[model samples]
Target: MTNTAQPPQQPEIPDVLSEKKLRYVDIGINLGDPIFRGVYHEKQAHDDDFHDVVQRAVEAGCEKMMVTGSDLKESEHAVQIAVENPGLCYATVGVHPCSAKQFDTHAGGPAALLSALEDLAIRAKASGHAVAFGEIGLDYDRLFLTPKEPQLKYFEAQLDLAVKVQLPLFLHSRAASEDFERLLGARLPELPKRGLVHSFTGTIEEMQRLVALGLDIGVNGCSMKSEDNLAVVKEIPLERLQIETDGPWCEIRPSHASAKFLAGAPPMPKAVKKEKWAKGLMVKGRNEPATIPLVAHVIAKVKGVPVEEVAEAAYNNSIRMFGLGSMENASS
Candidate 1:
């Protein structure tokens, strides 16, 4: 038989880019990832074009972005990125559940590791480089990366850090809702500003429960992968909703359920395969903060609201949640 298999189709990019500049705040991005620095799998594939990436995002109306620190080293790097960029970028410092093992394995032991994280958060918060405390929480779906016990233990421990610093949280949870909810509930009273459960791909009930507990939900491409996800997103209260790119990762692809909504939204620039990367172009498989508008477009479509309504609501909710200050002040 002749080979009947077909290569995957590339997502169609609209010919015209959106001219309506709507401001956005990408709540979660892993900027410390080597991909942003033009490194791929431990080797350099292209020149470091991090500034180019930032500039493209600004043109896309993502005026501010929060860089996620998945562990100690990345957390430090995230603060550095925020410091260097000033108001343009902020950092979230914490050990993701996947890296929970780092606590016990640290040279100075778990207490010392926690102490170091506390110190980083304190200084960064004072300097306004760190706006939230996290990228931390449970991820049972990938338990192979970490066990449940330490995830639970240190998730609570970090909650304590959040209380100490009095900063809002940038949280995560996947296939671990029971313990995630339980732990967060126990600490909710202590965290006045609450936090956001980002990249939420949970059931409507889970979303409702978290909202009831006074938390906000963050959506990205990965959060809208299927019809069920769209249904859940539609029900999220406008005031309780926020947006993020979770970038260098969750770009809105043509294959996602959100793609159909991209019909009339802003068009992304040309994308080249990583090996053939150039300035002013996006890497084919790498997501960037610039595509944040597509995320807003999808949410607006699913919720039957205008794209502006979604963008503005998400922007205000993020500014309020992360204490980014009034819109006028922020834009200034």
Candidate 2:
């Protein structure tokens, strides 16, 4: 009989809190998502508290955040956010796989659309508003939003653009690792600063493959949903691991496997329903960069390390990958 491999058991480790305040860099955030502006599903529900949200994350020790761009408009907005915030925020410019069909439906035509994306990336990089080029890759699980063909075609096209833009990538992959790796692998030699695969929830094998290919793995609440997820987090090399809130989504829930490790984490802001939102209060179910420490805490617990170690490593890894320079240099 053949035996299947099992996930290695993680030894129990005591959760410890360090007196030193650890800094973090949230490598992926949908800061331009309308939800941040009190708009949901195309309707304004409350006052825009964007600055307040940024304030909370700052108080929580999240010194830098990468505003994610999942499409052309979002990419433009991301750059603007970075420019306005300066060192506190940076942007990633690229279309997500779920939005790949926009290439076909764009009024400017596919060639013009790709050209525009390249233009944004190049311009933003010049001004230091953009750090990575992505949120682009394959997402087979959400084929309902976009067909497999366009996803494949546009993913390849974006890879070419990444080569031209010469920025580190901010990639995504969901249930499409085969084609994802194949396409990325072909372009590896040209992309010296191979980027991260954010919100990763893949298995040990997949994680190892990406790491072997010189890419980083980003972890968030979605990346720690189950026992299997914890195992994957444990195996991630400290140097190659980065953390993100992936917020306004991927909030850590009470039911998540990572929640058990949050016993000693810093207290999150008081949460209120969006309708009852007030200054300094977190919207009840919405995630924010303020929760980045909780992610580091979970990884530390699962890997039998100190929270500060995880926090420091993730912060440095993110800064290096995004080419944001030293935190001090960034502020100056």
TM-score of candidate 2 versus the correct structure, residues matched by position:
0.92
**What is candidate 1's lDDT per residue for 1-332, written digit by digit as tens?**
11112212332222344466899999998877888879899899997777777777777899889999899999999988887777788999999999999998999999999999999999988777888899889999988888989899999999888888788888999999998999889888988779999999999999999999999999999999888999999999999999998988887777888788788877789999988887778899899998898999989999999999999999888888786544443421
Clash pairs detected, candidate 1: none
TM per model?
A: 0.92, 0.92
Instruction: Please report, in order, the local distance difference test score of every candidate based on alpha carbons.
Output: 0.86, 0.87
Cα error of candidate 2 at position 249, Å: 0.3
Give the per-residue lDDT digits (tens) of candidate 2, residues 215-301.
Answer: 999999999999999999999999999999999999889999989999988877678888898766779888988788889888999
Range of the 10 consecutive residues with the lowest summed lDDT in candidate 2: 10-19
lDDT (C-alpha) at residue 260 in model 1:
84
Q: In model 2, which runs have C-alpha deviations exceeding 4 angstroms?
A: 1-20, 325-332
